[model samples]
Target: VLSFGLAGAASQLLGDMAHRLIPVTDREAASLVRSIRTAPLLFGWRGSTPVDTPALEELLLRVSRLVDDHPEVVAVTLEPVVVAPHGVSVLGA
Candidate 1:
């Protein structure tokens, strides 16, 4: 699942969301990332700077791998993730 909203927005109020089955392929991850309504923000809306979206896809892939490899793990939550021009950062996990 992927969702975006104003910073510090509640999970339920994210407004835009996308979801796909786990153990996602690279293609699926990329599709999932782009499927979000706010995806244009990552691709440089208007004259704004674009963020490292491929890095976000990679992060999703890594999270998928973690879940696929660890059956005991039920869920993962990464909050306040910062997506910058060069990379993505997880402020909380």
Candidate 2:
């Protein structure tokens, strides 16, 4: 089992929330990143439109690369993960 701990108790407190999960693999992850970076499909969800998905995906790619480069980070566990159709907001990152 993987256990995750939070720091900055008060400052980082997420205040309990819920989220929808989307399972993704390495290839799929890369593809999703690429699509968002290159396409405009991330717009128009609910009452929001043009959410700057490309920018968000680029950030996610950076995080992915950072994790891959750091060999010492054996496992990663983060929360408050937000995934929209065209973008993702990694609140815990």
Candidate 3:
């Protein structure tokens, strides 16, 4: 199984995040979404459309698996993963 942890926009000043050791389940992924202080952004705040959180969770899970499968990958970084109502895009990595 994949060994994973928190994967998202986690900053003390901006927002908070949830984390787990590895093999995070669907329930855990949902919980992680709730743990974020800026979670409202994901669920749609004001006139903004809600983001595809499921996609984000899937991405996280996939990344975790990739890391687990590749021991040579000591570290990974995916910055500015843009999420929208329809889909998500990786602006940088």
- Measured over all alpha carbons after superposition, the RMSD of each candidate to the real structure, in angstroms, is 2.6, 9.8, 3.8
Candidate 3 residue 25 Cα shift, in angstroms, is 1.6
Q: How accurate is candidate 3 locally (lDDT)?
A: 0.68
lDDT of each: 0.78, 0.45, 0.68
Model 3 Cα shift for residue 73 (angstroms): 1.4
Better of 1 and 3 by lDDT: 1
The alpha-carbon lDDT assigned to residue 42 of candidate 1 equals 79
Q: State which candidate, 2 or 3, has the greater TM-score.
A: 3
| lDDT (10s digit) by residue, model 3, range 7-90 | 444655443546665557677767776676677777878878888989888877777777777788877777668877877787
TM-score preference between candidates 1 and 2, better one = 1
**Which model scores highest in TM-score?**
1
Best by lDDT: 1
lDDT per residue (tens digit) for residues 15-90 in model 2: 3222112333344444553442223333554555655555554554455565567767665655665556555677
Checking candidate 1 for backbone clashes, the offending pairs are: none
Models sorted by TM-score, best on top: 1, 3, 2
